[model samples]
Target: MMMRIIYPILGMVMAFTSVLHAQSARITALPLQKELKLPASFETAVEKIQYDLLENENGESRIEVVDENCLHIQFIFSTDKAVKQDDWQVSVTPAFSPSFHWAPHLTPTDRHIIDQHVFRSPALIMADGRQVITLIPDLDIMKKGTPVRWYLDLDAEGNRLVLGMSNSRVDDHVLFVREPGAEYPAGEVEIGFYLMVNRDEPSLKNPFRRPLEFLWKRWGHGLYQDGNPVDADLERYVEHTYNWAFNSWAENVWQEFELNGNKVGAPVFIVNYTQSPNYPGEVNEREFRSVWNQAWFSSLRSAGGLYRYAKRTGNTDLMEKALLTKELALSFPQVEGFFYGLIGTEMHEVEIDGKKYNRSKGWDTHYWGNSNRNPYTWNAAESPFHILDMSWTALLMLRWYDELEKDERLLRYAEQYAGSLLGIQSESGFFPGWLDLHTLQPMAHLNESPETSMSATFLLKLYELTGKQEYKEVGLKAIDAIIRDVIPSGRWEDFETYWSCSRYGSDYLVGKKVARNDMYKQNNFSMFWTAEALLESYRLTGDRRYLEWGQRTLDEMLMTQASWQPPYMYVNVLGGFGVLNADGEWNDSRQSLFSELILQYGKLLDSDEYNERGWAALKASFVMMYSPLNPVTKAQWEKVYPFFGKEDYGFMMENYGHGGRTNAEGEGMGEFTIYDWGNGAAAEAYNRILDKFGKIK
Candidate 1:
């Protein structure tokens, strides 16, 4: 019986190989043309690239390259043996030309193969400010049972953009693995891909929306479950979201600290938890914490959410918690002198439960198996003050003052921060990314960062709030500077996250001395930040150019999102954004943020297209929430992360990995570790959405 089955399979494999061999007789590699000034990076023109069809056996492989406006490569694999293949990968690597530089996407310098979660685009995009070359894998070949992973290798040896099929039978959060058996009837297969070279146009929309459309057809719009709406009860979802957040704070997130010799306990938002949902383990006895940091991840941001949710539901306890968060944020030490009025972006020494944490200023140092583990190394206590973080935090505080509380202290703090910014405004109207703690000179990245320029929005808001002409004048000047200096470069990236390594004029990166562009760009958050600032400029002055620029940046941001759904039942990919450039992972933290921006743009411009897109984004925001009300996602969530009990319903994980580990312990598609930025951001966005849209259900 075994022999009969084996013989038939063998016959099928031989027949397939013979057919492929016969069809490949006319396939030939084209000769390189020097007169055309063809790029040396072209693989077909420069190298004799080939593949072996049979395992441990040499077999005929045919390759055909078609040269036109785009380079098209077609291949057919022929094997003599009757071998079967259940797992296989096809990859295309492009050699980079010296004239074309790789775009900075904030992935590690040494990264190669990237999982779908972190895959930036279907194409490996490279640009030299003018021309953009994109190498995209054929979508047909990538639609296998397992999720697709991309291969991007860039170095002196040349660059490669390859696509591969992942192992189908993966455990929870498992990314790359190979089962030692074959399921396919034959090993014979065909693959094809193309590379297009084009001029980088300012009006360029996402040319890679094809994969999104394909997935929408295959999976029926990511927001739908069996043609029924998933996020129907936006009000209930918003309430449940807040409940989960308050519960998380009560259960695991509250940090008890003795500040200035006084016992203080408040809901502190940590970056992430890896060891367990409770307090993460120590890194040099310093606990991993977010502290009073970036406004987007700070407790102030969480407080904003708590305040709105409490107002909507009339929960006084939640409102008190909100006020506590605000107080905790303002309690951080402030700077004096040249950087007077700005709160120093330094970690403070506080005793937690009789043990002193933040002794060396290393929060989020070694939380989720990350490398930068030593507390003494790259300590925030020794780092320069991040002006972007300070200004953004102040902006949020001021907003709270204007909307709810007209606190005298809040107004004073805003005035001080604005005054410091006014004094340091450069002749070019650009603001430095970081300032020295003591000297108050520009410490990191002498060049203007589009991310930092977003502080201009705060100034505009303050100007409106206080009728300060100086704030308005400097704010408009900064906007003009962005249009003059930054827009032309097209490097509108958010580099604020990595202050240690994102310096321009100096070789000081973290503890090591490196070149200017060592850290690379972080994420697509800058595009949205720039867009928001530009849009605010447009709204304030009615400048059409600012509106256009805002639209362009918003379009650029939409490109970073996952347009395609991977062939995974456990994880949802559509509308999800990756953690970093080419880093290979996705998370649901920014979904509501993206939605808010899109909706704001839609309302400002009164465009139906953007409005529709915004609604879809809003739906995608809560798609990952592990709530029993969301039956589809609830069941799907259980499949990937079964550790969640009924109490963990409203919980959301930090990462929705394509194939990366879910947490330190689990090897699966999504993680179990919760983050304030993840769940907190969602809750805040939903609350704001409720106020704006008024019960989306």
Candidate 2:
């Protein structure tokens, strides 16, 4: 094919251009420094920040500071400044909390300008080996004026990179201070700069089969503090999840409710680990997103996961609970075309530029389309249209129903849902994000959506279940739509094909302190049946493009795969910053099927590297789901959220460490955020992988 030929030629050209540019580029590493001062009115209670006392420290080093938050401040004193101000042109390491080495869209844009004193989040730049490193200032500290001021000297030498910070040579270094307050803690800050030297510059898009040991060694951190030997034990993971499930059963995460007066057991997973009626704040009201106070489509995921485990280990205690998931699909309210949700329609208003567009929208996330009238402030930004979750749930129902053939009613439900999905198929393979349930008019669809279509697999299932060529036809058409977007175009490259609802990928989000998506463009969520959909299509259709696109996504994901090391669990492969944020830093998920997709990739590619990596990912997911000490210590987790058959897991301040977005409101992420659905999916994947491919020793 022309693609096979043209791809290499393009790569070679880019490489040659990069080499030429590198050769001609003069590296003038300017010395950078800034005095960062915290204001007096700083909040007392904060996230993971630590301060420690030095042992028998001298007068200057022993500045007594008392603060509630942990300020594990590491210091590199002024006396021991490595790169002096005079010879600072060689390189400059920055002083700040070392996070993921994100792309330094390191340009300075002055927002908080006090008169002529513009507050610049001077992105501290350093040259480490061949890679140019940008030390991003954490969001908490970018606003304090001249103290946050940083300027550099690079204009004299062709102005390659640092002109954004300074037009003229001001200071080759930066000074930092955590200004004085009762809570701010009076202290002489001994600024320290940590350099994340490049050990291996693996191309972000290629090289799929590298060992995780290297990834752990270079990127992973802190899994052995308690001296617990690291073990990627699938059995152990399953056991821990089993305990979690049984505990939740006792807490009544699974409840009996009346739907259509049939007395259906809710058998659902609550969206938040801390979902309580008493709690009503931005973190609470807004955070409890998924069908609060009841169960919905997503609730099926955990049950599906549980079913997978039961089949794997021959445990049938939870079989009833798992089977109860049939209610999810069965109870869905049939609407104009297909099954919309379990509830009726509600009005959704989006006010853009002061114009309100209010329409009766079909339910997607909240329970059965019923808001449950849970008290909270609502906004247009809280868009309620998730095609992927519904698609996955529908597909899951069909798969389970067909595989078992136990419940004929559920089969009817699945068939109805499938036909409904057919009704909404867009000409361009576009699944409208929001739909006016009454009119059934396309209100809007998210371009490069975070939701992946189940059309291909669902169609195959429909064809198998009913022998319908039309279903297959629609499925192929949907696949075409996806392949069109996934394959690199003249406007976008293959790299951007790790595409989401937004056209602008993570590459554009580098250096931005606040992760926001006001532009509302193309974005992506990895765990959304994205790669799996294509690979599954490839399996059925034998379409090389499906595999190629799937492989392309897998390889590009290799690029975003964390630089985090061990004991530092909690990677949000599920696409973080919540429902609206298609892509953003720090991800957490309850989509249990992510690992299964990885397992499928390994088998399809026949690549040991993928198998190994997939296993590692599953293991890490297990740890994130079960390990109490990952981001929160056992004591901390147990104190607030006692794990009594209740799993304590969430994003855990593991923001960019797991996932990020170009434009996200915030990490609607928190601690002890475990969902049984994801647990089930994880368990299912773990079992399948274990049975298919034993531990890679």
Candidate 3:
């Protein structure tokens, strides 16, 4: 019996051997290709020879040949990915008869191919046996703004495959291929590549488009009249606003009033308009402008000064202003050292040509009137709660001082100020938000709350810049107190929680409270300030908890929306209805209905809804008060109106016309006559938003 032995051809051998010569050839110009055998199973049958110029699957033009045993190929097109002469690989395969079934084997694994500055590997293989190869190059040395490239080789039977090439510069590239066979070169191939580049440029357009110019254009020109350019009037308004805040205001109250005896005027005490009854009680008809206490004015002036300075110089020109404000604030009457809060003291009465008018009532007895009454004093060992005003003022001073290049005089003052406050911190990390100015006794009634958190935030700043352990310790204590007490008690539960201590009846004193409007009353400024404090504290201590708490608080505040009324009016909803009727209306408060809403919504929190709401309110308020025109120039405007309409303006004038004026009734009655705190507050809110998100010119 004759037995025929059949030996199964191991396709593994073909794979291992087929690429051996190609690998050797890459390292050296050796004749390794000559030693390799073109497997008989891998056949190239030349029924016909064809010369064709074709673009390779890589988007490159190449010369190709067709024959029985193999199809020879040469590339002509060049790209960044095209392989250099030294990186090329070549393979050959023997022809097989048409009747013989020859299947080239492909093993997909984590193996990689390295070329000149490029590394290639297979990422995936489809169920149909199509190999996806990825190419990557060294990124460190790659030049910017360059294109990338790639190349591939196929055997005549297409049984053997080689990949090589270069392009601009890329991290990786990919190509897909099916199992090689006699018809390999004829099969479809796919190449995939990716690139990323940067395109950045500066522009002159206002990024934030603060309604400043827009409002001016709308009202300054022909918005009300027939035809007018209005640009001139708009420019005047811009200049006036800038000059008032930066130049005139800064130079006059901020800079002119120096601690070195150039005092502009005596420090005055003013009443909380809400707490006091209207002037000329029942019969006397006179317009009046609510005056703020010296400390309050100083704070306002300093803030305005800083804003103006930053705008004009792109630097801290307000350092002097801050220092002056601090000094004058420290010298406030009634309160010995630093003014704890707004004091309602009788300074002078409205007089015409030296005639004495009705004496004004004293309103300087309490801070926030009924809520906090602690005088501004810090007793190292006794004060129950550390007052935050002193610390905040000191912090603002220090920050401005540092920005102003660390003037030794300012630093010395700051150090002294910071040290005095630091002495009052308790071992348990509690500080008072109010204290007796002369006795240095902590006002326990104020309670140790997030108000201290505000102070602690500033203390952290002092520690960071001065490397003072005491400040840091005090700051940490403040932070601890808030974390342990305030946060746990949900002091930040809602807008109302921000001012947990202040409430009228059941509602917090925010805007005019309408029973329907649940918006919490309180200064939204605290919201941004608290966030800033938390973020700054996190940076100083590198504590994860600080960051986490800050982020959480921020998230909560962002989700809460302010309540709104007719004409799309919005007021940052405070606790509940107190002064305003059920409809959210208020007749007693001087605050704008939506001042806090405008301040908190879009600017600090990045809420598009709030931003739109704020814009709408601003527009409505402008139209209601200012007739959308320049009062002085009588020019038609398009953007913003500085003052209200003539009638409204007349009302405002009358409201402020205490000496010899009649009380008028109507929107214009108390309009411009009385400087609406809401308008200033809203302006402040707008300013803050611009400062935070407005584009730098």
Candidate 4:
């Protein structure tokens, strides 16, 4: 390897030349065009560089690059014997608007600098949107065999981008490049990266998809078990799930009365649940009682489950319950007049057994709770209105109106929710992750996040149902924002739980200094949700470009999933997904949602290839469910956890703690809470699957 490094630099001083033909162009020796800023210490250190074609039409193919657009470069560092230390980084300018992971071009903010990482897939899409240039480091050379911790860098201004190989690490979503006494190494170090320019038009294939496909085929496919004794018995898993729903989870509606000091003219559906005593932690007593005001938790998720089950079995009584569940969901505390559609993003205490309790009050004390933005105010103006809450609720209403009933009231509610979104849409056509309920102004630096596709999804759904021109126009614009901004650099952040950043909600309103904790970088749920939205865009418009973008995003999202089981103790984890950055960590709460969306992509595209992968993902979703029938996994759970000795059909573990800081270094089998995001969401996914595919044999 050392001898191989010497040959590339033999002609390092050759003059750069561009060879052009009628149809093709090539650069024989690449020149540094941008005024890249590097540390003086690194500049002073003795070094040499080697530039060559990494690959052309045919060569040693480590990565695919167009013969004309590929360039290989290597940097050799000797030593800095002076013992002086300084933070090291190199920066280059991006020539594109709506740049991602680079400083956000349209909405420049401090937040953009926080999400820098090795996996960001740093790239710059040209303004014409027809071509993209990607900078990919040779990971094996940079990190596997070396002490280098390579990370990307982006300044708050749109002018600078960096690929930092030294004195950098993104800790707790903050970029920390300054290390005390950090100096150049003593030995020869070689750093290498590839630059490939590819056509980004709809007709051309995405260049980034190749590596992800290689990973999935080489590692991801082999890890999954065909007949795992977990939830792979989809027939039984679906049956027992619905059985738990109708029997233990469902609530009936009675006459209007003063229950728990609030007038309930309509039926109330309870979706909240307690932290299982079997799990580690001091269980909250209040969590045993259902709480109101949460969009995903209180009713919407479970309503979908019941509605689908009713439709499957033609159970009129269950159908009425589903309708009532949706009604209770819509009746949550909402903003009036100008923000008429904004719903409460905080949980309100509910009376259970004649005592009021806030289920989510003490949740922040748990390890998983750090992801939630808790202790938020109830004030409409100060509290941040989570877009997903309104998006999901509006989508449910529209779906119900279209499929179940033509009730004009449902249409009115959908219009109000989506119309409010239009009022707050950024000039870029994306909605902020959070907005002040009163002023409709963006909170924190959330206006530029790419995951606002959650809102675009609902708008497109409404457009499909009503053929509303305004809805179609705004929805397509948001889709355009996604393609122009999100696809170039995969900065999929700001898709945290609804209550995230609530702890600093007041600080954001008062213009006080607050830590940049709102950005949830590389969250899988956000990516999956965005993929579904892109598919919806493609479905409504018959645009293959949307399909192309959606496929690329899903390939990126797959990196979050466990391609292989860790050699950890306890439960099966082959098919689970890790939350942001913990690539090997297994099992997240959004498995079912991922399964559902991927399955939809397969169905819509009529691609048997994706359908096969989708089924595998669906099977993966149930691996976390503790089933009495699957005694193999149950015993395994008991061996490490001892908590799963008590089986609960409706309860699915959110994160298995197999790998990641999501738990105590992946010590236990699961996290503490068994809330709606897990159980209710899984139920909703399974219900959707059952309705569409029929008994999942």
TM-score of 3: 0.42
Q: Model 3, range 23-63, lDDT digits (tens) per residue?
A: 22123222432443334443122111111111222222121
TM-score for each model: 0.70, 0.56, 0.42, 0.62
lDDT (tens digit, per residue) of candidate 4 on 1-697: 0111111111223324222111111322223212222233322211222222211111121222223444454454445342233333334343343222221111123322222222322232222244444444544464234444444444424344444444433233222333344344455555555544444463134544544444344444554434431444565666665555555433321213332353432222233223343445433343222333233343555566767777778889767766665555555544531222222223457576676655432212211011123225534334466665567667777777876668787788778777678887889888876666557566665566665787788888888887888988898898789788766555565534223421212233222211222112344666776788888888888888888889878766765554443333245554455555323235666666687676777677685535555665566566666577656455545554555433355445565542322222334455333435555556667777777777554
RMSD after CA superposition, every candidate: 9.3, 15.1, 25.8, 10.7
Per-candidate local distance difference test: 0.52, 0.38, 0.32, 0.49
Candidate 3 regions exceeding 4 Å error are: 1-260, 265-386, 492-529, 555-697
lDDT of 3 at 123: 12
In candidate 4, residue 654 scores what lDDT? 61
The prediction achieving the highest TM-score against the true structure is 1
Report the C-alpha displacement of residue 272, candidate 1, in angstroms. 7.5
What shift in Å separates residue 684 of candidate 4 from its native position after superposition? 1.7
> Over the stretch 36-108, how does candidate 1's per-residue lDDT look in tens digits?
2333333332222233232433233322233333544444444554555433443333333423333324323
Worst 10 residues of 4 by lDDT: 1-10
CA displacement after TM-score superposition, residue 690 of candidate 2 (Å): 4.5
Ranking by TM-score: 1, 4, 2, 3
> Distance (Å) between predicted and true CA of 572, model 4?
3.1
Give candidate 4's TM-score. 0.62
